[model samples]
Target: MGLNANDRAIASFTMAGHALVHWFETSIPIFLVVWLAEFDVGVALFGIVVALGYAPFGIGALPGGILADRYGTKRLIVLCLGGMSAAFLVLSLATSIYAIAIGLVLWGAAASVYHPAGLALISTGVEERGTVFAWHGIAGNAGIALGPFVAATLLIFLEWSLVAAVLAVPGVIAVLYGLSAEFNPTAAVEEDVDAGPDEALSLSEFVSNSRALFASAFAVIFLIVAVEGLYYRGMLTYLPEILHGLAAIEGLVVPAGLEGIEPADYIYVGLLVVGMGGQYVGGKLTDRIAPARGLLAIFAVLAVLALAFVPVTGMGLAAIAVLCGVFGFFLFAIQPFYQNAVAVYTPADTRGLSYGYTYLGEFGLGSASIAIGGFVLGEWSLTAFFGMIAAVAITGALISVALLAGLDRFIDTDRSVNANADD
Candidate 1:
């Protein structure tokens, strides 16, 4: 099914607008650390607060997917952006730590709507689904890359409140773009497919039990992807503190010295950039090479880097940083892989539920990593935490490799038997 001119234009617009939303969300992660400093809150308390901000994303994403499936991707996106903008506006007025939590939950809820809509749009609209998925990834990575830089720059002169208010302004343009574009998913799905609201899962039960994923072949792949999610998020959460620890050990003091750098503070910019670079490279890799092999190699390299993260020096840390980029590249770039794979694996009518399940792996499993990483970090030094991270990456790589291998063996054995039958 070839997409018409209008579909192409809408896809591009949605992609661009979603990029801005991602930038706003991904970059502000560092804000928690900064907010703690600004408000003089306890680190443990702030950790919990930060964790709270992330927790809802997994919980909300499945519901968000359902909304997109039922309501229309475009409308859900517009509403998501509008709601997100409001959340940021709330953030701009916040004074206390609890206010930050309130603002985050609001923003996170809005964020939950985007992935399923965006992924579904890409799946249905694009001819070369992998390429479209890659572009979606690039948009997301670009936003992730830009977020910290923007947030860091904003903090130099303005209050966090003012910064958040200003951040909400871009979403206005996105809302306008969505509204003026004459494409709303909700109306279109009804007109086109005639899907109903009664089919909608009961909200409370849906929210409470969505994480209880059903077991299927596709679901297993999602589980592997979810494990990857845990490593991906876990690695990002602690890399800053880990890198800074290495720098301190190396005595490679910057112009400002140790005080100049803070925990999870100094490396935010580096992490974002690395992730972006990784996605760019990963995009090319996936398009040129098999997604299976590409994912395997990338995860393998990531395992090594995670293992080597601590107990390394100047050149070593720099090398580690670059590998981190590779990790981000393959990790995020492969998102499109799941999008493509799931599309082919599942029937069209139930695409929303399929995509939702995939996200359950990505977001839900990924969220668990925060507490896991935190506990690991507390139990053993950054070095030990990273070792565990490396092990997780190894597990992911093994799973991806095994999946590809099993798929190949099944095909090969089938071919031989068929050849003998013909003879």
Candidate 2:
């Protein structure tokens, strides 16, 4: 019932690492508002600059995973933390928009190493997979919530560059902590630890495994993750702006204590804060139910809620709060399910690569949301923007249905092979 010492250690370090990764990733959006003012660029140009950083974060994942599988997960993680710390320090010295863009590209590449390394470490290393994934998702959402909250609070007094430097502190500390820590990844499930000659695949062998993974249920899972990434990146990139527009139209009152900060930002942060709970509940559900069933239910609700978000923003604060809370809940709640789905559907030997590809879709292709959001914002209305996101979510729901329908095939294939091997 209780996590052993090793479990606690692994969870603490991995969770801390995840939180810092998110802190760096999400903090950029908070600063983007300031960048626009300082640089005198419109949202479209700003989005391009932001995407420059984001695209590599996605692109680096594939290699990050390959390196993790070869060099060891701990090594890649330390590299990621140290690299991110240095990148943020680079960002703090920016004198021009081009300088800032280059720094973001550095940050993005460094940041890309995290998801594959961290998620792969946990998937293969931990036993209570769902709970660990849930806590991991919570840590991520905490970064999402706090990154902006901290940036906003500091911006009230400090300059943006100084704020960027201060944010680097956690990454530095995490790197130091990682250096002195030890791990026992050998204590994982029997199959993972004993994955035979294919445990560490050669490049050609890895290519073969990757192909097989895609040909099976994992490909459907990848598509679902891609859709989720698009929706997530597209909407969250400009949620504060979207909410600001709605609040202005509906005439919502700002609290006296928070009057100095934008009301929409507070609402944006509040929604993410609420999503922390969603991560917990979603993690729990993964342990109790089939992950596909959970994915189906979550995607379906997300489709409805995504469509409803713009309309609800005009209804009043109560309606906005309720819908946003539900929306935030489901948004994060799906993480563990899909993460769990990856492990269930892939081989023990290639788990690291599996997560690498998973996040490749989740963050890599997901990075396009910045440009997509900008284009829609520049050319279309918020209603149209959210409509497109809703369509993607609905598409993910259909994919989930396919995953569920094919579940038996996935299970039977595994059982049949194992039975033959035993015979």
Using lDDT, give the best candidate's number: 2
Query: What is the overall TM-score of model 1 with all chains considered together?
Result: 0.79
- Scored by lDDT, model 2 comes in at 0.78
Q: Write the per-residue lDDT of candidate 1 for residues 36-155, one digit (tens) a residue.
A: 568886544555665666666666877787787567677788898898889889888988988988988888778777887777666554444544555666777777777666766676
In model 2, what is the error at residue 9, expressed in angstroms? Answer: 2.9
Clashes of each: 5, 0
What CA RMSD would candidate 1 show?
A: 6.2
Alpha-carbon deviation at 345 in model 2, angstroms: 2.0
Error of 2 at 388 (Å): 1.2
Q: Candidate 1: lDDT of 417?
A: 20
